[model samples]
Target: MPTFTSNTAQINFQTFGDQSNPAIIFSNSLGTNYSMWQPQIEFFKSNYFIICYDTRGHGKSTAPQGPYNLELLGEDVINLLNHLEISKAIFCGISMGGITGQWLAQHYPDRFNYVIVCNTAAKIGSENTWLDRANLVREQGLLPIASTAAGRWFTDPFIQSNPTIVAKLSNDLGAGSPEGYASCCEALAKADVREDLSKIRIPVLIIAGQQDPVTTVEDGLYMQHNIPGSQLFEINASHISNLEKADDFNRAIQKFIV
Candidate 1:
């Protein structure tokens, strides 16, 4: 694993493929680290350079105080690119990560050549609802909701076939720092990009899980409708569709990027 330092926090990251190749950056979902993009990394590493980093307060990244919002988190990615001297890259983000990517595309369009957004919406849950969730995770450990969360994240077949993987991921989510999780929940709660979509001029691909309970296909359709010239692809899985339907998801992105 590699790491980088930004103004706010030190980020833990891992890279794959040749540095000279075009960069493909993948942002992980909430409560999970960059490892969530394992499937995509394996598939894309053979061609494009892949960048995976733990969002601040998740994985190995340091957890600061609460009250953080999308803009701050988005800047983390911007600073990471600046640190790497990456002038332009293709950005992909899922769930909470997708919100960050959308913000990045709107604020720093010059830094990204293309964008792939998955299982996310321009406006996430109501702020109060997310704040309540943050309070819940903070008071009680993530363990209490791990099973329910996993169920929403994966399809029934996926849960049945990949018990070990689901269990491990659940544990990982359970182990994340409560403050970090809460901060991100605030970010998600405050995120709304419906007005900003028109500003994105780069090629965009929107992927959705047909069965995703958290961010449904309707959300993908909303993005396609709003972002000019964006394409949409739906798969049969839940929130963590890319993991459950790794092959289909990776292939879709490969074709889109090429």
Candidate 2:
């Protein structure tokens, strides 16, 4: 793992495979760190240069004070690319990361060849809902949210069958920085790209989870309908579809990128 000092924060990131290979960056969801993309790293390491990073307020990345915005989150990826000296690469993100991808494709279209957003929406939840979650986490810490995260993130059968995986992600959320998480919650509160979707001219792929309660398939369809020529691929999993249906997720990526 390595660190890049962006103008606003220090970003923690890891790279795999040959740098000469075509680049592909993976952005993690909320709560989890760059490690969430382990399955993707293993699968794509041989063919693509994989870049995975912790968002400003998650993982080993430095957590700045107060509320952050989507522009800041989107810029972090751009800064990482500038540091690596890669002109353009494929961008893939899930949840919060997915929303960041939308912002990136809208604002920095020339920097990416393709953008893949998974398990996310143009507007996630109501502003009040996100603000309330931020307040709760800031006051009572991540325990309450982390405890119920599994139910929101996975289907019942997956939770029962993959207790170890579920527990690890849940526990990681519980141990995450409350301020960081809360700030990101605040970011989500104001992040809405529905109106800007039409402005994104680059090729885009939307991956939706059929069973995701957080960001439903309807949300994916909305994005597909908005973006000029975006494609949608649905998997039979929940919020964390990449983890739950690794094979299907990877296949989708391969199909789109190839």
Candidate 3:
């Protein structure tokens, strides 16, 4: 476990495989930690230097209070790279992580060789929706929202067949830090990068979940359309498509990065 200070945050991150290999930094989703990227480690470690980190306010990282924005989240990654003496690497992110990826791709183009964004959107949901969620979490807590959020994570069939997995994920969501989750909600609510798409000059791969209701396929399509020469691919799973369709997701990433 490696740790670094990023502005107001203390971030926890880890690396795998050889340092000589190309680095691929991974950012976690909103509630989950670096563990969310477990499915990718073994497959990529042999060929690439894998970097996985718990995002600010999640997992072993500090849960600083605030109305956090995408810029702050992006800065966390930049600061982490600076601390590690890493000049550049490939970036792959999912959900909240994906939004962070977009911010970096637009704002820190010099820091990445390629970018991969999965199950995310330019503007996730309306500000009011996230405000409502932040209020609910503040008043009641994550337990009340965990069940609903989990439903949006995986398809009904997958949930029915993988009850244990669903339960575990729901528990993870329920156990998230209230202030962390709420602050991220504020970040998501305020993020709208539709104008920033053209700023992505490097190669990009956009992955969408065919069944994702949280960030619809249309959202991914919008990014694909706006980013010049970007490619869009679809997975049969839901929001957490990487877990639900690990083999396909891994294969797509392996091929694209090569």
**Top TM-score model:** 2
Listed in order, each prediction's TM-score against the native is 0.97, 0.98, 0.97
Error of 1 at 15 (Å): 0.8
lDDT of 2: 0.95
**Of 2 and 3, which scores higher on lDDT?**
2
Compose the digit string of candidate 3's lDDT tens values, residues 1-258. Answer: 778888778899999999888999999888888887888998899988899998888888988987899999999999988887889999999999998998899999999999999999999989999989898898998898887877889988888898887787788888988888999999999998899798789888999999998888999999999998888989998999888998999999888989
lDDT per residue as tens, model 2, 1-258: 699997568899999999999999999999999888989999999999999999988989888896999998999999999999999999999999999999999999999999999999999999999999999999999999999999999999999999999999999899998998999999999999999999999999999999999999999999999999999999999999999999999999999999
C-alpha RMSD between model 3 and the true structure: 1.0
- Candidate 2 differs from the real structure by a C-alpha RMSD in angstroms, to one decimal, of 0.8
Give the range where candidate 1 is weakest over 10 consecutive residues by summed lDDT.
141-150
Residues 94-182, candidate 1, lDDT per residue (tens digit)? Answer: 99999888888889889998988899888876889998998988899677766577887898888899998898789889888888898
Superposition error at 57 for model 3 (Å): 1.1
Model 2 steric clash pairs: none
Higher-ranked by TM-score: 1 or 2: 2
Error of 2 at 191 (Å): 0.3
Q: Candidate 1 local accuracy as lDDT? A: 0.87
Task: Please list all clashing residue pairs in model 3, or write none if there are none.
Answer: none
The number of clashing residue pairs in each candidate reads 0, 0, 0
